[model samples]
Target: MIPDPTVRLIGWAVTRTAEAIVDRAADRIATKMKTCIVMTVRHRAVAALPKRGRV
Candidate 1:
């Protein structure tokens, strides 16, 4: 149990820490999603390009 005098500060610290963790996780997920989208587009573009000189 937290003491009354410091409880507010403690709660603030915990909340801030949780928010930071959530923010970092969100950033990582966004980066991975962006990378996946870019890769998919690249693959599609390459596949759509006209092939030449194949016997």
Candidate 2:
């Protein structure tokens, strides 16, 4: 099964990959959406601020 946009966009591949390997797809998606904001901020990816504002 393919991951959704949320998973890919978040780019937390290690966590996502572990989840996938464990068949935790929904958990992976939710974790991605949840963590993306924090990770982007940590990485200084301000582009997410605009996207978050739009959302």
Best by TM-score: 1
lDDT values, one for every candidate: 0.96, 0.75
RMSD of each: 1.9, 18.9
Off by over 4 Å in 1: 1-3
Model 2 lDDT, residue 19, Cα: 75
Clashing pairs in 1: none
Each prediction's TM-score versus the true structure: 0.88, 0.27
Return the TM-score for candidate 2, rounded to 2 decimals. Answer: 0.27
lDDT string, candidate 1, 1-55, tens digits:
7788699888999999999999999999999999999999999999999988878
- The clash count for each model shown is 0, 0
Best by lDDT: 1
